[model samples]
Target chain A: MAQLTFRESIARGIAQEMRRDESVVFLGEDVGAAGGVFKGTVGLLEEFGGIRVRDTPISEQAILGAAMGAAMTGLRPIAEIMFSDFFAVCWDIVANEIAKSRYMTNGQMSFPLVIRSGNGGGLRFGAQHSQSVENWAMMIPGLKVVVPSNAVDVIGLMAASIRDNDPVVFLEAKSLYSSKMDVPDGDIVDTLGSAKVLRQGSDATLVALGAMVPRALDAAEELATNGINCTVVDVRSLVPLDTATILREVSATGRLFTVEENPRLCGWGAEVTSIVADEVFYDLDGPIVRITTPHIPLPAADALEDLAIPSVERIVTTIHKSMNS
Target chain B: MASTKVAPAQSDVAQKIAMYKSQFALRQFETRAYDLFLENYVKGTSHLSIGQEAIAAGVAAAMRPTDWTFATYRGHAHTLARGVPMTPVFAELMGRTNGLMAGKGGSMHLTSVEHGVMGSYAIIGAHLPIACGAAWSAQYRGTDQVAVAFFGDGSVNIGAFHEALNFAAVWKLPVIFFCENNLWMEYTRTSDVTAVVNPAADRASAYGLESIIIDGNDADEVYEVTSRAIARARAGDGPSMIEAKTYRHGGHSRADPGKYRPAEEIAEWMAKDPIPRYRLRLLESGVSESELLEIEAQVNAEVDDATEAAKAGGVPGEDLLMKDVWADGGAAWRN
Candidate 1:
């Protein structure tokens, strides 16, 4: 095992795919010589060279449009939008064109491409750059949505996303960039729809995604000392949701709580909660609870931003109170 | 196989004849579509390329079979020009199971990947950058294949147009941005909304490309200009933009009657219709009238057969509804 940061694992994952498939090419602003804005792609340029690793102008539409066209042809391209929130500038291409092209064309063409973006808050970038819009991509029909919580999952899931035949919106948490973990040596490929059960407990089931996974695990640890054991499940892929595992875990515990980093309104948690409520209504011990960031623009101030987004303290308190009641 | 040798002059004549046949095919196919729409056979709206057959014919004639062609919503002619059989084109417009996209794309989004007609986009200016991307791929693969993007004058003003142009130029991608300047953008005149007289050609300098404008009604001119541009792109000389000045014979869609244009302007353009003009030119160039008439008859017969075949095609089955949503050929999102 080797210790690697989430940012390093991103480059390692992309490099692994590029080495495996000659068709895979990557492009974005400052991804070439500059090693990406977030430095998530630090060593790609030196290893892959300029032909495969390209740096485009600050044109989101062109970046995505080019990637789509390239994907439809012969190349398996990975295009990056600098920030996740920058999707607003080029949502039409992502939502209308890339998402609908294969279906509209009746599978005459398949886009083997991945759109990678730096997503979510906890960085002091404020509203425009920090919003978690994984839900935005989850709603689109033809796209596979993935958000990895740790360095290991990042390498594995990034490989899977690149290998996927359909378009995948791979959202990487900006807050988790510096976080480090030991990943096994050699290629680490994982399945797209499988959610990993991080911690096993009996009292309550906690489903979390991306940045929320680590927090949920911490909360579970703290809740255990208070005599309330919680099971934490990391939902890696949102589109091809592993409802079998989720429903099984929820049914086993007979109580479920969602920990979401995204805003409360129609978040991915809502979808999971709805499915659990509908399918296993009789198995529930109490009403399912959701701990999420409030439905408001993320504030710039640290205190307000921390208060808005769900914290480890909040998750423990909510699950503890609900279980006790 | 027996070897057959032909002179260069004869080869040129053959190309011209093929272009003429393509033009005839587009005109007849579009005329049939119009009749079908009136008879309620063609469901939804259709943006016809009735009077602008020369551009599609000329561009297709110049392109290699492997070259990719991207067209707009007004793209039945462009699709047919790539030698995609009229049956699938007709069936797609009519929304039948045998359609080019199995009735998924409808009239506005006909696509035939086997024939290199990548897609027919409905959104204005969206496919320009996409075409550039395809061209970028070809360049990366070190192929002589070129990508051509076809749009109306209205697309010139969209942000994607400018972005695609700059992107292609910066990367020196092998793409041709072909703008069919059909005078009107829907109900309004393109000239009123556009800043320059030639929407595509005049803006070429901003992207370090030569400005070019052709008489879209003249098949010979379109063929020659497009051939040159294709050669330049194939030779790695970078992208080119061509503005073909033509006029649409009808309104933007089947719904409008096109009363918005002045009577005199309409009459002038109708008189310059590409079909008759190309036929007259062919006759004047020592091509026998009998030969031209024979070609027209063949196209008419073929179109008639295709229309019948499309009408006979059934609606799509329920199984196809949930298929092809993902690469797995199923729409199962949850396990």
Candidate 2:
């Protein structure tokens, strides 16, 4: 019941699960002696030792393929790919191998595997490092994608992802890792395929994911004084999306403003926009708006990188414009 | 780059005939599958291992019933050698309800975990790391089970191949990297593609793994090498890299005439056809020549029956299309 940072929550969640289940193993580059480059795996090697908490070579293909194999053969391995950008190298492994094995086997195979990676922008690591590519995974069937916006969801979703039968890509928001938030004590597992309404409102719906939720909440806080009550929703697990909650929220408020770190076009926000137009077309009072990074590579320049991603001010302005339109 | 992996051993006549029979069955099975595929008997494509039957037979023979195996798209021989029934294999190829994937995975993606043929990868080099993981699982569980991966020379350059080799070596995983170096990477030869010497055995040193090159067409050679490697793996001596130097008799897939391959090279390999070579070897060892032909006749009959069963194997029920998309009750389908 104490405050834990997002990184701490993930480490604790993984540690807790590893302790509870003997089949659970943590394998990744620098996951052992280095305790993970981001420190999310800090105390695991000491607690679980080298056997359970393994340090693997820097190979995304092996990390994913081996994890898929391990999962197929009874053990539940939690594999950590350092950056979401590196998932590019593992496109075939994930899109084809891990994601399709279960169905290809006629449901005979169970891939109780979790692939965790650091995602999103704002620290200015540039194009190669800063990218939220959940869309790549969400586009694939059988692979569940989860983006935790806060420490609480991180712990809850991380636990649930590990226990899930299908392969899950758990993205830990890089910026949110240092931010501290209070989480419930004991085993806290949440349902996947459901979105949580962080703030309820009636004027317009603000659908945000992972890192954008905090910024969306910030925009909501500022919008409150202007008499624009915005409902900020965290679309936690994007694949098995919480369409019911989204449709209901959009139905209540005819305006929808979706936000995320990835490019707006063909992103999760656009998917949400299409869902709104397709399902509840007549319910719209204004144009569906998506506030996101432009379709370009993220730059190393700090200010330009900030310009590329969505911000609190940007989200608020978009909300106001959507309300006006 | 080379070692004494092919040590001499006393060969029993029964064991020799049994190995030869499996290879004979694979040659017949691939030929039948191809014939049916060309005549529109089965939908989609299939990568045949017609010339490389010995590698599969020997590898399957060396593996324990509980040991796992991940193979490439040209995995018919591997799967059949695992002793998976021809009905399911044919049923899968024909897109039938009782098929391995219940008509979903055609030919490129056939999986029969019950027989320990852990789904063949359509993408080359893709299954290498997965085999390492299975080995990792066995190691984690404290079991002596081993995971074997079979890929062609084309897959050696792929990232998974190198990664799996390194991971298996560092982790001391009980696995085998069985490279079926047919010389060509799909349409191109390995000589044209990469600069590494000894395309098979030379790559093992990079991963610090024990490696050997064997005549892939010889069932006894494949059996001897893989058995020793499998023994080392089961004894926790770590992974081994065995490159079986075989040749692909036909084109890479359906409609490929393989004109790109030189006629003389083809003739040379054709003369060294594994099935006949093994048959002659058995006869020379005083085993009955009629006995070998009888075995081949039985295999031919089995192939004919399998072909009939596969044709009658119907497509899955419509309701089944939605099944296995996710675990039942894991999440709700959009209403």
Candidate 3:
């Protein structure tokens, strides 16, 4: 087993995939010589050379468009959009073309493409750079949205995404990039659309994604001290959601609480809550609760931003409130 | 700006007219298809390709089967010129089980991967990015296959069009953006919307791409410009934009009569009808009139056969409604 930071894990996975498959190539603004803005692609250009690990112009549309085209033409392209917030500049390509090609072509075409973007709001990067927009991608059909919280899961999930035939929106939490964790070194391929039970409990089911997974784990530990045993389930893939696992957990606990960094309204939590209500409403002992960021845009002020996002304390409190009620 | 360069390999008027006759066959097919559609044989809304036959014929003639081509709603001519069987195309428009898309994609959406014609989109400039992506894939694979994206003059103003063009130019992808500048985007004239006067190709310079403006009514001009663009693309010289200046004689759809177009402009454009002009040119260049008549008769017969086949081809079975949504044979999600 090798202990690696989240950034190194991502880089290792990409390098391994590129080595394994000659068709897999990486394209981004500074992914070649500069090794990405966060060094996630460091030393890749030296190893793979410029043809495979290419540094594209600062056009997000081109980066994504080229990746889609490349994927269609028998190349598995893993494109990096520097920041998740920048996806707005090229949403048309992502939403319409990438998502609709398979269904529109009557199964004649497949977009085996993966788009990686750094998300979350902990670096004091302000509103433009810090917004969590994974929900926007989750709403679209024919796209698998994966959010890995740690180094091990990131490496495993990314490899799976590269091999998957469908297009995947891989969202990486910026704050968790430097976080270190022990990961199995050789050929780590994880199953997509499956929730990982980080810490099993029976009192309440705490569902989270991306950065919120760690916070939910922390909250579950804290809740254990207070006699409230909370089960933490990391929703790795948001689209083809692991509803069976969620339903089993929720049914066992009889209490549910979802944590997400995005705004409360129309966030991923709402979708989970709706699923639980629609599928297993009668099993719930209490109403489902969602601990999410406020409906306002992410603030530039560090304190305001911190307060805007859901924290461990919020998750713990929401769990307690649901248990008591 | 004219330079005395070496002549093309085939500039004979007879060859040009033969190409024009092929285009006329496509035009005749579209016209007869529309007539059948009005007579209640074909279901769904039909978008005519009355005046833009030359653009499709000229461009398709210059492309190889390995090269990719995509088009907008006015895609019948493009599909026909790309060698998709006429019966299947007409059956598709009529929503029959024998259709190309298995009767799923009606008039607006047509696809034939065997001919390398990537499906046509109903959206204006949506296919530009897809074409760019496909072209990029070909370049990445180290192949000489080029992608051609055909759209209307209105698509130039769209964001996807600009974005795709800019990306293609910067990446030097093997792609050609062929804009059929038919002067109307669903009742809005290109002149009324855009301030640019001469050719829509002028916008290509802004993206640092080579641009060519050709008389779309002239099949030979279209063939010449598109051939050069295709050669440049295959040679890895990067993407080019060609604005084929043409006009749509019919309405935007079956519902509108194209009331927005002026009678004088329509008359002037009709005077340059691509089929007759090329025939006259062919006759003047020593091709016999009998040959032209024979070609016309053959085209009419083919169109007639296609119409009869399409009419005889029964409507798609109700069970087919659930087919081809996904490749893995999954049921279509009703929700």
Among the numbered candidates, top lDDT falls to 1
Error of model 3, residue B30, in angstroms: 1.8
What would the DockQ be for model 3?
0.39
DockQ, all candidates in order: 0.83, 0.67, 0.39
| Candidate 1: chain B TM-score against the reference chain B | 0.96
Off by over 4 Å in 1: B1-11
Root-mean-square deviation (CA) per prediction: 4.1, 1.6, 2.7
Alpha carbon lDDT at A118, candidate 3: 95
Error of 1 at B240 (Å): 0.5
TM-score of chain A of 2: 0.98
Tens-digit lDDT track for model 1 on B1-335? 11112122223777888888999999999999999998999989999999999999988988899999999999899899998999988998888988999899988998999999999999898999999889999999998999999989999998899989999999989999998999898999888988887888888989998888778888878877888889999999999998888999899899999999999999999999998998887787889989988999999999999999998999998887888989999898899
Cα lDDT of model 3 by residue, B147-184, tens digit: 99999888878777777888888778899998888888
Candidate with more favorable, higher DockQ: 1 or 3: 1
Best by DockQ: 1
DockQ of candidate 1 is 0.83
List where candidate 3 sits over 4 angstroms from the true fold: B1-18, B40-44, B311-327, B331-335
Interface RMSD of each: 0.7, 1.6, 3.2
